[model samples]
Target: MHLPNGIFMLQRVQTVYMIVAMLCIGALYLWFPSVEDAAGIAVIERSEPLVFGLIFASIALAVISILTYKKRQLQFVLNRLNIILNFVLLGVFVYRSLTLSGETLVSEKGIGVLLPIISIVFLVLANKAIKRDEDLVKSVDRLR
Candidate 1:
């Protein structure tokens, strides 16, 4: 599809950041292992409703933000929401790992816990870029 002149989503730095953050969240679903049961089998699968819902929400937010690039304020708002979601995801990971019965030590926690943190960082960067662009627009508007 031909994007109109300068409106291509991929042309924006924040869009790239958002896409990366989404990918990281996706990776978290696939790579991160859930708490293991007494039989040593992972209790939660990526397909689990709760886990899948959060991941889907995160990816959807990123995509919606990217599509709303023409509306900088809306994009910024969406990015902020996405960051909050990532924080929630991280908290869930922490709570799950810590509350597991009889499980101790840091090594048992899967690398999945870090994915939300990574997603948060990238979302923050995207928000910063969006803010920068918004500032530039406002300054230019003032000059007119």
Candidate 2:
């Protein structure tokens, strides 16, 4: 089946990214790990300002991305900005994983590997979508 010009491919990857983001936010709800389990995270989490800044920035970015996807007339700036912002958020996650108090970097768990891998995949797909969008615009301009 042919995808329409404006449609986003690799949406499933974005869905997965979004799902993981949700899971991370819900992490606090799922279980408050013991201080011992917290590793370095407790120390990090307590610096309330930095953690809140990260949370709000991520939320704003997610909202912007969603709004960009929904608009019929795409703004090129938003398209590029969205990709950069997603990468920034990905960096935030990487920082959280690395600097949290308890542990060495690169846990043995398979799922931990998936997060950055997933972010990178979606970043590529989102750029592809933006390129497709610009190409479509060029085609339309040619027709005119």
How many pairs collide in each candidate, listed in order?
0, 4
Writing each residue's lDDT as its tens digit, candidate 1 over 17-94 gives: 998999999888777675555565665556678777888899999989988878999988898998988888777767
**Candidate with the greatest TM-score versus the true structure:** 1
TM-scores for candidates 1 onward, in order: 0.85, 0.47
lDDT per model vs. reference: 0.81, 0.46
Task: Give candidate 2 regions above 4 Å deviation.
Answer: 1-48, 70-76, 79-117
Model 2 / residue 92 / CA error / Å: 5.8
Q: Give the clashing residue pairs of candidate 2, or none.
A: 39-102, 40-101, 40-102, 41-101
Off by over 4 Å in 1: 1-7, 34-40, 104-107
Best by lDDT: 1
